[model samples]
Target: MGRRTPKKKSREIYNAWNQTCWIKGVTVNPMVTLEYNEWWSRRVNDNISRPNLEEARSIEEYLRVVPSELEIIKQDFKKKTSELEKKIEQLEEENVYLKLDVDL
Candidate 1:
């Protein structure tokens, strides 16, 4: 009955937050979702009666930084790729020297 209103409003917040997360291509982590829930509660005290689209959108943007492991992996990939390229050049130089010696 009357109880449904608060529950529905809460769902609106979760829906907006989840939708924004989906659009931003990030996993909906519990910690961030709980922060959103707390923010919604505080906004209710400020006479905001509906889920805030802007708030949800901003949360997604804030959480969108590349994860630390992914950054480390990217750096490692660059290092390994450079090392492999250098090794290939060295091998090619040695092959040229071997060919010259064979001709001699």
Candidate 2:
């Protein structure tokens, strides 16, 4: 493997933070975001001082800012759908958008 340049490393850290830490549709608290980013910076940066330290530090800013987005989504889904909702009259409907929130 080849060594990554400083700018490349910075961009990679920034991209990783954005992709992994962002929870959509929620207002993140500033203090919490700061703490989260600090933790992530320590983990990824490992005390290595560099020109693009800001991007690496930014990765930890996400800390489930909405409490529990998944739980809320699940509860809402269950409230809206019932046992009778499982039935579909059109057999072909099964072939389209088939997804199992089910696991075996």
Candidate 3:
């Protein structure tokens, strides 16, 4: 096909975009409707840079989440608390042994 001008290309996009909004008896000017104008503006300005297909990941990979800082800190806290509790138990046992040694 011949190269389509930017205005023609946008008009085609607008026509395809609004194809479903047709009414049997009523003709609507897409430019006149507030919804269409808003949609057009968004469509024009919504160009976001995205990774090409080669760099794209699977859905699961995209959806996967790394542990947040709070979660990591909570896990570390739990580990430290458990270690301290074990050390406290060992210290209590040592104290009991010392008491027995003194009482002997």
Candidate 4:
């Protein structure tokens, strides 16, 4: 008979769930964020000094910057949506004039 694998401890499962919640909410503490940023900077600086580097370092940097990048994207999306709404309103006004011209 094959032996059964052991199940994960309840504490480990709870910690994993808690980490998921924190990540989903982007709820990292400011001090933790600063420390992570510093660690990333040091890693990037060290990679720059290397003779040849893989694409992984760039990917790592992207991961490090993702939260700020996501905020910029969100702002840009709102700006674009506002501009689109204005354009849509203008088009509706133009359509009304075209309908009046047809009716006449």
Candidate 5:
């Protein structure tokens, strides 16, 4: 009988470790996911093995910009809501005046 090679033993150990990891509900780290996605995108874009620092920097900038943009949108919504409420109140007062005129 032939003996298993060290590479085969290592493969078996790796498989066992993966199985145990799944059974224990161990998850892939979010940083690992982000790194892997960035690496994969870089590979697809330039056929390169390393992440693109420029692209990563741009993504960081976009993340920073998003909150300020969201704040502007929220403020606009609040202003519109207040304007609508004032219009509603004015219409209600007019309605009450019309009802009194009709009753008289």
Candidate 6:
């Protein structure tokens, strides 16, 4: 009987802890729901106003993204690489001609 009593008491404590955990886990705030509902209704019902012509910007200006310093450096490097490649090709052609002239 004594052993049974301890087991029953432990079971009751476990049930109570589980109940508290279940209650804490559920978020049932009616105030937050009401505020969100009100905001949603206002957003859905409100009229969208047109932009003022005086302050309106062109789509191209609004969408244009400025290149960063890294991007500018990459472009310069690419140009220099292409120029060096062309010079290498020219030197190789001259070497081939010089080799042919020596053979003849």
Q: On residues 19-73, what C-alpha lDDT tens digit does candidate 3 reach at each position?
A: 7565522455633778878988888877766669998899999889989999999
Q: Tell me which of candidates 3 and 4 scores higher on TM-score.
A: 3
Stretches of candidate 5 above 4 Å error? 1-67
Q: Which numbered prediction scores highest in TM-score against the true structure?
A: 6
The true-versus-predicted C-alpha distance at residue 102 of model 5, in Å, is: 0.5
TM, every model: 0.36, 0.21, 0.42, 0.36, 0.36, 0.44
lDDT of 4 by residue, 1-104 (tens): 85444554666787999999998677555446777889989999988865555544675676774458888999999999999999999999999999999999
lDDT of 5 by residue, 1-104 (tens): 98999999999999999998886665555336777889888879886567767666665667774558888999999999999999999999999999999999
Candidate 6 lDDT tens digits, 34-88: 7798998888777667679999899998999999999999999999999999999
Which pairs in model 1 have colliding backbones? none
CA lDDT of each prediction against the hidden true structure = 0.86, 0.68, 0.86, 0.82, 0.85, 0.88
Off by over 4 Å in 1: 1-67
> What clash pairs does model 3 have?
none
For candidate 4, list the clashing residue pairs, or say none.
Answer: none
RMSD (CA, Å), each prediction: 20.5, 27.7, 15.5, 21.5, 16.4, 12.2
**Residues forming the 10-long window of minimal summed lDDT in candidate 4:** 2-11
User: Of the pair 1 and 2, which is ahead by TM-score?
Assistant: 1
